[model samples]
Target: MKLSDRQEKIIDLVRVGQPVTSVALADKLGVTRAALRADLAILTMIGTLDARPKVGYVYSDKPKRNLLLDYISDIKVSEIMSKPAVISESTMVYDAIVYLFLNDVGTVFVENNGNLVGAASRKDFLKISIGGTDIHKVPVGIIMTRMPNIICGRADDSAYEIASKIIEHEIDSIPIVETLKVDGDKEQYKIIGKVSKTNITKLFVKMGKSK
Candidate 1:
């Protein structure tokens, strides 16, 4: 969410001053108390300010590291995820290889009827390529690692949680998915985006530069 000029000033004031009364802020801004109400409420809701019954408002006490974590924690996977490299499950291993290289991504999501069913990585392609088998005749579905074995992130998952999943799985990328109910009892994930270590690194770099 974007902050208004008055709200930005309010944040600056709270950061440098002791708990400041709304009346004082209103006077300093040459506006009425009512004018600052919405700004204060928004700042408070976004964790930029804290208010008490009689103490007025103050900046949050969160340290720099914790503040960065808070920022990351509030970012959803959808905000950072990039276009996924996708292929049909029936795509031949040779075609999948070409697609992977063209996309320049580490993994490709395999889909059937628009729902994620499997994924193929460089390793999966390599395994088949080196077997001396006919890559052109082998469908990726035969060698792709199917869902239930795949580690994925939800579109609403926090950036911090998705980053943790990447580290824990020791994989280059993970598909961002949305859940769907099928057949009245089974659930499936539909791939929507992809997140990678590179994306996380870029986020950290951008945040650091902002500091």
Candidate 2:
């Protein structure tokens, strides 16, 4: 990785000073410690610098491009996924809509016999609600996007995988599911959680707040 002029300067400073603190570096650069944080984090992440408790920063002499695992890619779906709002496929569309609002989620997963069967979005509920059809009478299953059509991910999946699928599928949420073997050894999906736009945003916000 090509070092920025500031990064090169940081290296020079650390090499000469040995164990310099962020406060001292900020003073020398005529910038606040906050301004130096990103640079220092990058430098530390790429093994260009080492941070010690109380002792401060030191030159590590590591290759700048030793970038192996990026932080975002290292985050798994299980870490960021939220509890899914699930409803029985037999549930009335109006009841399903109520559950969606109660959970404050964009999409609701539908399950039958403990196995995920389908999914319905807020738009689906809204469309059915406004149509001539009586939402109170219609089963959510009738309007649901059936399983195998609804995109899903596993707990072990990377957050990046979920994000890419969300963009490509143009869906607001993706259910996190697991395989269930039923009678005759038939495979089924068991809905456990969901990853939504809000979940992603919360993860990023939490990451930003972290050291």
Which numbered prediction scores highest in lDDT against the true structure? 2
Displacement of residue 148 (Cα, Å) in model 1 is 0.5
As a whole number from 0 to 100, the lDDT of residue 89 in candidate 2 is 82
Residue-level lDDT of model 2, residues 1-211, one tens digit each, is: 6879998999899999979999999999999999999999989988989999899899987664456336677899999999999899889998999899998989999999899999999988888888899888999999999978999999999987898899999999999999988887999999889999888888878877947
Residue 84 displacement in candidate 2 (angstroms): 0.8
Give residue 64's error in model 2 in angstroms: 10
Off by over 4 Å in 1: 1-63
The collision pairs in model 1 are none
Scanning candidate 2 in windows of ten residues, the lowest lDDT window is 62-71
Clashing pairs in 2: none
Q: Report the C-alpha lDDT of model 1 over 135-187, residue by residue, as the tens digit.
A: 99999999999988889999899989999999998888899988999999788
| Residue runs of model 2 more than 4 Å from their true location after superposition | 1-69
TM-score of model number 2: 0.69
